[model samples]
Target: MGIKSALSRPLAAYVVHRDRQWQREPVAAQLRLLRRLAATGAPTAFGRAHDLGALRTPADLARLVPVRDYEGLKPYFDRTQAGEADVLWPGRPLYLAKTSGTTSGTKYIPITRASIGNHINGARDALLHYVHATGRSRFLDGKLMFLSGSPVLEQHHGLATGRLSGIANHHVPAYLRRNQLPSYAANIIEDWEAKLDRIVEETLPEDLTLISGIPPWVQMYFDKLLQLTGRPIKDIFPNLNLFVYGGVNFAPYRAKLFESIGRPIDSIELFPASEGFLAFQDEPGNPGLLLLLNSGIFFEFVPAERFFEANPPRLTIADVELDRQYAVVLTSNAGLWGYSLGDTVRFVGLAPPRVVVTGRLKHFLSAFGEHVIGEEVEGALREAMTQFPAVEVVELTVAPRVSADPGQPSRHEWLVEFARPPADAAAFAGALDGALRRRNTYYDDLRRGNILVPLLLTPLPAGAFQRHMKRLGKLGGQNKVPRLSNDRALAEGLVENP
Candidate 1:
């Protein structure tokens, strides 16, 4: 490895900074820079802490900044592109990643050269980490599949495409070109059904050693693969060894990947963003995830318990504790400083602080003021399914509905699927609901008060995830499934049948 000083820019600085941070858990110099950045980010948030110049210790980083979601930074982004003083960090960035945000619209996330470097390098490093973990030198055999959205967007002001941050996997690196399944091969975001046809038609080959993307997208590919071919996955991709996934939890979709594929492979979970690739599943057999601390960004965590508190402790890389769930935050050199991304994570064990994704800090249901998260629901579903390990919970989404009565509160209605379902539905749903209530007291109270009735379970129409995937134009990737849905359209459509 050699230094490309000519490529020195935001990305270079970020990679360098990340390496330094890893060698030593954030040093005093880095802490000072962080304090100044946090102070600026704080006022941008809800807090009023200012004028404290000399931030000497890690404790200062722990001081609470008024919680600010991505919405708070929109103004800064607008000003930056306008050639005005970019209020957020202070730079004219390179390009932006078009991400589907929490507010139900496409979010154009700014990315500097640094952000781009982090994403590419982080992904490469993550792949390499997987290789090391599995003790394999070469990726099993054939092409690498990417299940992502149409990356062809408006041409970037500087050069080629504005979709680089999200779709760069399809381009940028020459190494990826030899074996690539650009899911959006039609040169457009075609209709969902047509798109899946393209995906299915291209992926039928058996040379692929690894398949990667969002879990839903991966599941979608398999559904089409199974339906069109009518063969077990082993018959399709006999050489497949890794089912690399990210963007959401894998526990719920675990059975689908392992059972439907009907073969053995690594169902790995990773934490990546438009900002950068970030963390990945590091330990083998354990399958527990760890941050490539030296990847390309700095990391931070806000104490999970402070989730609703007026003030919460922020954990610097130095202060982060193992085994405790916390809110994830980052400060990549892409001009994003001390940015809180609103994802929840927990340390799996100490030693090197192996972490497991707890859940999304945002993206939860609290209709009756009870915070019901993805992790809680998935845990309950997985535990209940363990009673019948032979079956898997393919695609299950929950919606919070309040009953139409004076004192009634909200309840959860679930839509679930199984490859070959078990004989009993009533017992499974009951057991799942019980596990949920036991884990979350708010859920128990809701049921007790009739605020929420016991969980309603609906066996979806055959191939629901696949149907949604086809409708959504999902291709091959870890991104196939519609992970969370608030409305009951998918569930209700099934109720009339099962």
Candidate 2:
């Protein structure tokens, strides 16, 4: 057996064992593990505050610990950052992952040694599961390029702090490190353009088989590679066979990204965050990711519709029903207890418990009593973009255009930065408006009643969104354009960019 196949044998076996274990006593298995976590964490200030020591069951734990957002938990985080030991977890964390979430301006997610181990293990399991399902291990013989943030972490309160990708870069397994592209020095450069240029310089000739990154940035690299080499990706790297991505929905970019590849390649999705490694696509033909139950995180769900309730009902692994949207909550080894991740997902299955990310809880447009979410907007845009095949969307956002005059009805405003500008902007906007009306009943009703006017489309100058992101200090890697903002904050910000 080759090196990767040999290593994956045992790992795949473990994954299979865990899968079976989860299937045969899903609730009991999860509860048993959660109790152990609570017991271990009982000595911490947060645990004691919630009386975690006395909690013996999932129900008991849920009843005692109220769900909290990052703002609510900031006091505890402040304590930890001030060098207090055993505040949330067992000891002082080695680093804090800095993330700029759409809702939360800036969050410092604690990263413990134990939690980082889970992150690393979860990522490996995802690949191993891919190997097991596809019966393809030879690709592992070639290099794997991870398009990630810089490896250089900034120190905060004597502890390292950086993007989750940057923090993860520090923990690349020794075995995989040899197969990973770009030298250590080159990977640590902070400027994204500079780092990408260095990566291209270092990896162009390497035998890259697997590529992993958020879809947009990866797409950028592919565009640059094709521009520089004057050859399709398949011609540049014949060994390329896998594209693993997450952080943004791949539906809109799937066609464009695949076209760049110029050949069929398998793709996998991951649901990872700075707080924890949540889920990964395990089975190839499956629609949803396997909900990782035993992976160092105790999972909970609050109904999406009731997410903002003063004390919404928090459901455990056993209580979740298929086809219902829920806000994801977690108490993980990372020291975050009863914390809402601000993400909404729907359960597609219950037997093995699989889920698909729906959208962000805070990311919805409800300007005129018509609640349109990220999924709807993106789906509409993707459907409309099909008609204009020549137009490639680099970035886009939508906001309500409230009319100043009573006679003029409100409309939706779209600020789109296109890589391949459309042949006719007015026609493109009409197609998009039609698509949205067709997909969403509320939007259709509004349009039919003349409650809303035809949507406004502004084709932004190239790099407008990038310049806006740079100004906000959220330039690259995991930070994406908010598809449906309730207000014009994002739209105005991008429009103001020169």
Candidate 3:
């Protein structure tokens, strides 16, 4: 065995053991972390303004600081960007993770020195947990490709600013540096298509074992590799075994990804954001991710249904109930107070605080009073894919289409990009529509009442989603097409009629 593989087993055991200490006492750990964050933020401008020093409990936090999204907190973020020390956190952030925002345009989220470890350790612990569970760490000896943003940072008012993935690239552990692939030059290529070509050239001859990225981009990489080598990914990289992915649900892409590889492989899901590394899949075959309670962040759950209410109840770890959907609010060491992460989650396990991300709070379909979430659409698509084994989807998005003509009925339109088009397209649509109706009572009611006709399925031309993303200048690097939108904006841009 290689030295790294041999050492990994003991390290995995130690990491898992250390993890369980907090896992077993989630509420206590979270409470302690919350108190610590409050105490740490006590001296900051935001802390003083929000009375952070007086916060003794989650209720105090909720009452004192209203939950704010990026726009709400932009002033504080701007102050930090202007090089104001201790405005939000203890000092100017170590780096600003620049991310695309809808309303706010470019967002610079603070990543403080103290909180950066959470991001790094969360990823490390995920791998260690896999190693601990499977006792198969040989992949560490081979080249590991992390398909990520350019690691190039630009100065933004004295703070080093870059994409979160790019910022993360700088912090990859020294031990894994030798095994990391595609080189720094390939990573910094600004144009994604050009970058993919460079990456393929660099890694094609190497012994690549593990590949990690957001799903769609990974799929794009797999496609490129197959195109270049004219071989299934399994044949190309015989040692390739694990896929680490985050940012989207993998179910819709699983069949296509495995088909591209010519075999099934182990995969890990992570719940990470600019704000914090919230959770990771701790066990194989479990859909729920274990929420990191002691990761320099304190979490609050507000019922997603009542999230827009002026005074929604913010429940802490001890108060959250299993199976209920909640909007995640957080107070972190980076000095975000009562910040809404915008993602909705459902708790599946209370003991270790395992959660499944349902969808974005703002990224749902409610155009016709039928509130269908990301989970429902993904579940429906997964069910349809299972039933139609031959149908392999590349990408898909849904949007509600309201007919201007009174005689015509309004309907949800699904624009699907297929790797292998279903032999019976109508049947596939029926299966998808049925699955959705089964999951959502409002959708079922609308269907039965004929207020909305059966969903319209539009088979998009090959690379339709990619073309649209390219047009929008979001073709790669942590960008993803929303599963469903309330209006026809994304759908209209994605494809022409028929």
Candidate 4:
């Protein structure tokens, strides 16, 4: 074994042991974290406004600080961007993580010195856990590439500002820098296509063992590599084994990815966002991601069904129940107070508190009162893929298709880009519809009442989704197409262009 791999084994064991000790007492750890965040925020402008000094418990925080999304907290963010210190957190923020906003034009989330470790070490610990679990530290000696945004930072009021991934690029530990791929120049290339080509060239000859990125982008890299070399990914880089991914459900892309690689390999899932590194898969074959209890972020969950109520109950980790969907709220050391993260999640295991991200709060389709969430759609697709093993989906999105004609019934329209189209398309659609109905009672009711017809499947040529994203100037770098929309905006665009 190489020196780095040999050394990593002991470190991995130590980290795993330390991690499990805290995981054993999740509720206590979370309560302690909440108190720390409250105390730390007591000196900030927001803290003073919310009377954070008197807060001693989760109930106290919920009473004092209202849950707010980006627009609701824009005033404080504006102050921070204009060089104000201690507006949100104590003193000045070390960096600003720039991210795309839907209603707001651009969002700059603060990354304080105390909070940045949550982002960096969360990823490090994920790999360390894998090493400890499987004794597979040899991958450390090979090229490890993180498909991410440019590391180039643009200064905003003297604070280094860039995409979260770009900000993370600066914090990659020195030990693994030697094994990192795509060179500095390649990573800095502005255009994604150009950068991808450069990455392909730079790593083509290297001993690539692990790759980490959002699933779709990583699939793009795999496809490009195959196009250039005409070899299965396993043959191109024999050492390549682990694929670490986040941002979207991997079920839709799993079949295609493994097909490209020409073999099944291990993968690790992470639930990370600009706001915080929330969770990571701690065990092989376990679908749930172990929620980070001591990561300087205190989590709250509001029942998704009651999230829009005037005063929804915000429950702490100790109060949440298994299998119930809840919208995630954050109060972190990064100075975000009761920040609505917009993602919905369900706890699969609560002893140590493991969750699966279900969908975004605003990303569901309820145009016709049949509330179809991202998890349902993705789950439905997985069922169809299972039943129709010949089908290979590249990308897919669902939107409501309302009919103007009184005689015509409304239906959900699925726009799918297929690498391999299903031979029995009708049967495949039936399987998807059946699976969705089984999962969602409202949808099943609508179908039985003839309020909506079976979903319509519209196939698009390969690269259609990629082209559409490029047209919207969201070609790469943390952009994802919504799995379901209440309106026909995304669906119409795809159909018009295709």
Clashes of each: 12, 0, 0, 0
Ranking by TM-score: 4, 3, 2, 1
For candidate 2, write residues 1-498 as lDDT tens digits. 568757776778777777677668888888887888899899999888889899888788778888888988999999999999999999999799998744557789998987887788878889888887887877777899888888788888988999888888888887778898878888787777787888888989899999999888898799889989998899999989999888788877777788888987998899998889888888886869887888788999999889887888889888999888899999988888889998889899888889988788888888997888787788888888889888788778899999878787799998887777779989999999999988778989999998898899988997787788888766667777787888888888877764
C-alpha lDDT of residue 368 in model 1: 74
- The model with the greater TM-score, 1 or 3, is 3
lDDT of 1 by residue, 1-498 (tens): 112212323343454445445445434444655655554444332123332233334555444323455675566555665654434443456666766566746656677654566676666655555454454634533666666556665644442334442356544476456566644464244454566677777778637767777676677677788888899887787777777777777777777777768966865666777666667665566756656555445567888668667666667666777666788776655546446787888777544456777677656667776777777888888788888676676677777666777666456877777766767888888888999998788878878887677777767766766665555444333333443455665555445444
**Residue-by-residue lDDT tens digits, candidate 4, 1-498:** 999999999999999999888888988998988888888889889989999999998989999999999899999999998988999899889999999887998898999999999999999999999999999989999999999999999998889999999999998999889899879999999888999999999999999999999889999999999999999999999999999999999999999999999999999999999999999999988999999999999999999999999999999988999999999999999999999999999999998899999999999999889889999999999988888899999999999989878688899999999999999888888999999999999999999998899999899988999999998988877889899898888998999997
Off by over 4 Å in 3: none
Relative to the true structure, candidate 3 reaches a TM of: 0.99
Residue range with the least summed lDDT across 10 consecutive positions in model 3: 489-498
RMSD of 1: 5.9
Q: In angstroms, how far off is 454's CA in candidate 4?
A: 0.8
Q: Estimate each model's TM-score.
A: 0.80, 0.94, 0.99, 0.99
In candidate 3, which residue pairs clash?
none
Clashing residue pairs in candidate 2 are none
